[model samples]
Target: MRSTAHTDPVLTQSGCSSTAVRALQISIAADKALVAEVRHTVRTALESWGASVIADDMAVVASELASNALKHAGSEASVRLRLSEGQALLEVDDSSMQRPVARRVGAEVEEGRGLFLVQALAAEWGWRYREDGGKTVWASLPVPAGSAA
Candidate 1:
């Protein structure tokens, strides 16, 4: 695991370390209501970047990852978004050091499907131990050609 995220903007766990054309980040206390705010904020940022093509997907991925951090990590969680040339990167970090697992659940099940949703929507997703003492769960989605990433 990378000891610390780069200072330019604590980013990655993914190999796409290309400079971000645009970026934003925030940290919120563990609260269910705040999850919606994170979603909206991330969506707005994408829209401003002219990346409406992936707005909804980015919102859902952002909220789901935020929810996981709040519910599982049980501490303040931070989210970072980086739009590069070919992809939009979303990362959620929490104080807990434990890694996340993605599992398949039956349709009848109503819970434990957050990671599943992410897997379905994200082109690539994974987690890494943060040098500071937590784990950052990240996902990358393709940005269509001719659109700002």
Candidate 2:
């Protein structure tokens, strides 16, 4: 559960407060066994950011994204958390170019509803290709009003 956090000087220089932007990046293994670790990491990060109000939702979103990377990309991934101005941005980087698609799942199905759950939980979600090779799927979850930013 290694993670790193730092202040973005650029944002601060641009008039945002020092605590306005905080970020954490954690490396995720390609193995599905690590899904629980990833969820734990997300929970800890959100708690440390004083945004525990959204921890459960963010944790589920992170798990889904990490599982997708392991199932589809079959390669190591990285999870990044960016918290700023009452919003939390969760991103998972994986070595796959295949865009994520939301598939409809019947009640009896036991699989294939990762993106659907993400869409239903996240305030906004999308993906983009990385120049080096791979893609990053991201979700934005707003911190509940009144939670410390």
Candidate 3:
């Protein structure tokens, strides 16, 4: 969290932003304590940008992806949010290249539901292996109607 905030910087964690595409990013340690911080940060930024309608959805997506990285990958992760077209694109990058699988669990089960929640909340979601040997999972949620970027 101490790394420079580029408006929120880094070629790795943040792509910065211009008038054309609004973006903010933060690099997080594997510590579980920071997941809640990520959620709050994302929501606050969206509200400030007039995208509060999707803040909850993006926050949920952010926490789930970040948790997945922490639990399974056991490494630091980066969370980035951007306004693309009319959707809020949230991406989480971690050191693991292993793709996430959305498992089907019984209703009685409590675990393995993170991606399931993400799928239901996001407009669309997927993961890609990066050239740097890590992987990034991303979700795009629709912006609230009439919200400015």
**lDDT of candidates 1 onward, in order:** 0.84, 0.88, 0.83
lDDT of candidate 1 at residue 104, scale 0 to 100: 75
Q: Choose the strongest candidate by lDDT.
A: 2
The candidate 2 region of ten consecutive residues with least summed lDDT is 9-18
For model 2, residues 1-149, the per-residue Cα lDDT tens digits are: 46787756334555755555778888876779889988998888789878999898999999999999989999888999888878999999999999999988899999999898999999999999999999999999998777945
Residue-wise C-alpha lDDT for candidate 1, range 1-149, written one tens digit per residue: 11122224334668566444677887788787899888988888888787889989989999999999999888888899888766899999999887788787888988788998999999999999988899999999988988773
Sorted on lDDT, best first, the list reads 2, 1, 3
Model 2, stretches more than 4 Å misplaced?
Answer: 7-17
Per-residue accuracy of model 3 over 1-149 as CA lDDT, tens digit each = 63223332224334564343567888988897899989888888788777888888889889898889888889889998887556788899999978899999999997799999999999899999999989999999887558845
Candidate 3 at 86: error in angstroms? 1.6
Q: How many clashing residue pairs are found in candidate 3?
A: 1
Clashes of each: 0, 0, 1
Error of 1 at 94 (Å): 0.4
Residue 53 in model 3: lDDT: 85
